[model samples]
Target: MSSKRESPLEVFLNRHDDAAWRETLVTLLPAIHEVDRNAAQVWFHFYPLALLRAFQAAEDPARLAQELLMQGSWYLKDQLDASHTFLYGHRFWPEVKRAVVQLAGGVEIPNGRTLAEVVREVARAAAAERKVDESLTIGIAAVGLMALQQVGSEEFRRAPGEVLIDRRHLKRTPEEVLRERAKDEGQGLFGFLRTADRRWTVVWDENADDRRFKALDKQEVASGAQADKRPWHETDARCTVNEGPIPVQCRSASCGTCWVGVLGGADKLSETEWRERKVMPLFGYVETDDPKPLIRLSCQARAEGPVSVVIPPWNGYFGKYLKRVREGTSEEAVASS
Candidate 1:
């Protein structure tokens, strides 16, 4: 009997099943940003799957980073379908074309090709002229090209340039917005309790509108009610409050369970402790010297002012795993298990 052929998506997924691909994708992610106006929307769809794949890869960071640099735009194709799924459901190239056409004001994209193909073409053009660095620019340029195609080249070059989709046309600056929020909250009989100095807002999950927390100054945002205090892996109950629970355990950064991605207000939080800096890399989450980076240990990250953060869906002792990989004992450990 003849065997069935695997679909392109299946083939891509299978190719990345090895640890190397996943690790490389994860290492490259922080540096990857949206290239065009719709880049954020496109990336948002791909991030979860990309992160999941990275976590599953369980490879050594040193090797992963090197692979990412060498692979360049070729690496992005593996996760293209996943990104498309985020916006167009299970539909693939056909749906992507439709969406692109719709966004382009019904202008048909010449040559039937997927978004990834178009991005690769753009990257190649830039590389030909030596106008862009393949290592640093290709990944984001691909994403930007998707957004550009969706918006159309004509509109992208128009006056004031309709490049990115600006949903928030706020009249106030970030500081002004925060100031107004503080003023609005400090109005009731218990207004003193809600003073700017005493309390602040913690947007625990930027994607979830309801995940915002009204927290006290210098309070440990990860701690929950007595009933909900359980190790994050052991139970779903993290820290419980009136707003809802924020994930936690050990309340000390030892477990690596409460790590979060800081979306805004990095400057507002306390500086990273030596322990956090050392441990975060092992977790394969983030490795940077910036005192306040996008990644933070929620248990250790005390809130002093209003801030927004993105909680990863899962966490673990990936640092230890990475150590094993580096030592060449990871395969042995897996085989033994």
Candidate 2:
């Protein structure tokens, strides 16, 4: 049996646990604007290496991160470039790519440079090169470097220049684009009166005009997409069920596939339920007691008003395994005492 060598970048990433990443995110948050800060949070939830590490640490792991279903193409070596298209900073992907590669290729890992410092340095450099605010590219720059750490420099270099965004969008600045995403068209003076049948727009992809679907008052986000009946799978390969923009399996909370990040209008969604609250942490998506957190199970959360959401590329069930691992560790500790 042969074992592959671990890169220094991978080793560096391993040293930081989930708490370290969350702290680094908070450190970077002040530098990033509101929109990209939300994007960064979603990106962190989407590809949590901590979950991957938990799986690896288990004695008899059921599956690896890549083995999870409906995770999209990003986990594959060839799809690395397209991994972060959902981020607002995607417009500056070229710059982010170069910065990640340069960092990944470094032979020496600086002793005092934590993940936050590394992200800041790369983000500042990209922001300077693009002449845009660090807020725009900082999150995506973090996304790129974290991705390189997860996928390894060998695979990261394999997929170069994919650059999936449309050329028309490239002309606009990230600020202009983010503002457009935050824009909400009023439903009129009588909108509140028309409570039962009111329609709200759920912006699935902020960058595209045709990616939105209408949801009636108090309808689940996934339910609205399922009701669209417009053959969404043709446009997005992940939308395999009901031809909806967001991918889903088992309309109930049993499957974690329908998790989404509310980039805007989180207040408009229904509060969290026991099932959703319990499963979110198990799915390793979130660990929040907040009733209407940014991360939500679309199938479980109903939209009370218009919402802007970002669908993750993958989903899995690791809660049971993780729970067992924790219980085993506890038992071992007690026995040792």
Largest TM-score belongs to which candidate? Answer: 2
> Largest lDDT belongs to which candidate?
2
The weakest ten consecutive residues by lDDT in model 2 span 61-70
The residue-level lDDT of candidate 1 at 235 comes to 26
Off by over 4 Å in 1: 1-197, 207-209, 224-244, 333-337
Off by over 4 Å in 2: 1-9, 54-78, 234-243, 326-337
* Model 1 lDDT per residue over 51-92, tens place: 333433645644543432211111223333323221111112
Q: Quote model 1's TM-score.
A: 0.48
> Which 10-residue span in candidate 1 carries the lowest summed lDDT?
83-92
- Give residue 124's error in model 2 in angstroms: 1.5
Whole-model Cα lDDT of every candidate shown, in order: 0.46, 0.75
